[model samples]
Target: MIKHYCGIFGIYNHVEAARMAYFGLYALQHRGQESAGIVTWDGQKLREHRGMGLVPDVFNERHLGKELKGNIAVGHIRYSTTGASLIRNAQPFLVRFKGMEIAIAHNGNLTNTVELRDELERKGSIFQTSIDSEVFVHLIAHNMNGKTVEEAVMAACKRVKGAYSLIILANDKLIAMRDPHGMRPLALGRLAGSPVLASETCAFDLMEAEFIRPLDPGEMLVIEGNSVKSYSLLDEGKKPPTRQCIFELVYFARPDSIVFGEDVYQCRKEMGRQLAIESAPDVDFIMPFPDSGIYCAVGFAQQSGLPYEHAMIRNHYVGRTFIQPSQDMRDFGVQVKINPVKSMIRGKRICIVDDSIVRGTTIRTRVKKLRELGAKEVHFRVSCPPIKHPCFYGIDFSSKGELIAANHSISEIERFIGLDSLHYLSIDGLLRSVSHPEKYCLACFNGDYPIPCAGGGCSRACLEVTD
Candidate 1:
């Protein structure tokens, strides 16, 4: 699978606004963990605090609630794309531009970010984060023409390109926008009669908020002073970008969240069922890689009529930076990440379910561990199709030759991972699983990018020109 960026979220127009936005972002913490941030507007100004940590660890009932009180607010939990990881890169990017400071939190990658940044820098724009989102502020600073922040936002949108789902906070307004092509996910909601905005409808469900339509793929929705309006920014020069990033269904989003009115959990479950129907394994119990595969495992279990086992129990306490020091350290991290429920796995024929295989280092290691732990048989099942190319949009991976499954056939992969058998969901079956299938861009799996690649795939000229 191509490495994907983190999720983004925000809430607006509620009493105890900042605290409420915190909870909304808290529900979305699974989307991104590199950093978290929140900015609240208390009539006169915006109060902001963001740092690296999980939601609860970064925000608290005492300080987070008291210090961030406002009638309007926006928040973010960021994972970097097109920038190095560091404190300065953590988002909810705030900048003073054209006489007003606006904060922006972004979810998708900007294919043309390098070009935008260069143009802005040549004009004397100084940037704080290595993050691509900083370019939006610079572009806005240079182009804002309206007396109000909303007008400035509209002006800025005209100059920017590529995939973006943004939550932009102005002094008196919260403007949520999606690229005209709708390459990423963004939604609007309402709770207690106040309008709200979030990256997913699932957050709205968590708040018992009524779900509204997603921001039109290229439409901008402005929430200001308790009123809302919409604007179409489509340029005749460009067709809407069609790549919606199929990774969202396979790995990026929390299964509980909904993207573009489609339930993420349901999409994965359906993928598992379709996999079972097509691959029909000669195994006993089905197992899943902890966390991501839980729902798919359930679908596999129900479809195959085999019991699901917690063969590997994951440790919840291990931090992201917990790199093991040796094979023993690696094994120990595996033990911490998941330990075999010995009784459930011992001497049984088993099927393992996972979202996708990237490097295969983790899989090769894990499959061997299962054998050491006494699994009689191990058959592997992947929910998504093989990843043959690297993602160029905003995710970190770009070397096509490095993907384990890209060069290896199923039997070759089975031998490489040391699995008794292996299978992957067909690309067609994978597409059939998502709601509004026609709307998504499955380019990574299918190599069918909806828009022109600025010039062409992997060309330095294209990369430099578009980015």
Candidate 2:
């Protein structure tokens, strides 16, 4: 199972900005399920509603109508790449400093969080949340000495590293920025005449907004009243190479969304087609792991000329099992979330197509269950290459010890997962499936981190302790 990073949304100069943000968060619910939050600015003051759960569970008509009213707002859904999972860490993190009220919603992790946090703490700055996003607020506040909010934001951006796609709301303006590497996605849109921004185009679709374009790496925009202005954080002729996270196409973003200016569904389908060409296993029919795997399975079936069917049914109501805090709970949730169709697979040789395999436990359980349901033979095909390195730029697979591929060979993994055969798409195949492969960060598959991680390790301590 794979974990999702956070999603962020913001709107400026809309009558129902808070309500619109609520819907935007609903559309991005797939990106994060642990918590949801929305903060609004009403010209003079800020109002917000934050809670731990899915979007619908967190906000309702009463909360949206009574508590949040503004023309500018920002929303966030979190999955905890940094800090513990708690209410205090829930975002659209609101803070009051020097008589200015500001709210920030972030969608990626920072590599310099500990260093910045320590520096601020030593100067007597009190932190309200454990998440690295709070460091942005502190950094901006410290740099606000007779400077415009945009200037302060630029200063803060210069001080931080790693992946960050941010939506910052101040009393007068709404600011949006992406990291220099572009390791996360952030797009601009228009709702009626108001400016809108979100982590994916799917959010714009849900709100009936027209997508303008994706924010460039190291680009920052300031929106106020009905006007939008753009700025560059990087000095002229010093722009770093853009390295958008490749995994966003592989699994994170919704299939219906357009991320980094590419169609996610078509990309996944192409990956499936490539996988079929690379590893064509002889099987009776192709079966997907449900939802995320469905499109790839279709592409594989089309390419391999094999029958496709839904052999395993997924529970739409069940939240992602990977988000469960403990391994035991995650193992239990996986069983409850999917059930095999006994009659269809009673005596069939099935090929299972999934996005990627992380720990190997979930897939192992799935293969074992299929056999118990009387499957004659089970073959596994993964759309992406094995994840051999931990991701430090927002993905939750941050510990190398948790990745089975990091420790075992492909044949060993196949035997451990109880599969007749197992094959994964090569890195070259995955790159060919996308429009601009050179712009993607493939550190999870090949240890080529576009942005260097703190302490050169994959742990919470490593993120907090700088060399």
Candidate achieving the largest TM-score: 2
For model 1, the stretches where C-alpha displacement exceeds 4 angstroms are: 1-3, 81-83, 146-148, 236-242, 320-328, 451-467
Give candidate 2's root-mean-square deviation (CA, Å): 2.7
The residue-by-residue lDDT of candidate 2 on 57-121, one tens digit each, is 89999878878987888999987644567888888899987888999998888887877788899
In candidate 2, position 122 carries an lDDT of 100
Ten-residue region with minimum lDDT total, candidate 2: 458-467
- The C-alpha lDDT values of all candidates are 0.76, 0.88
Top-scoring candidate (lDDT) = 2
* lDDT, model 2, position 2: 72
Clashes of each: 7, 0
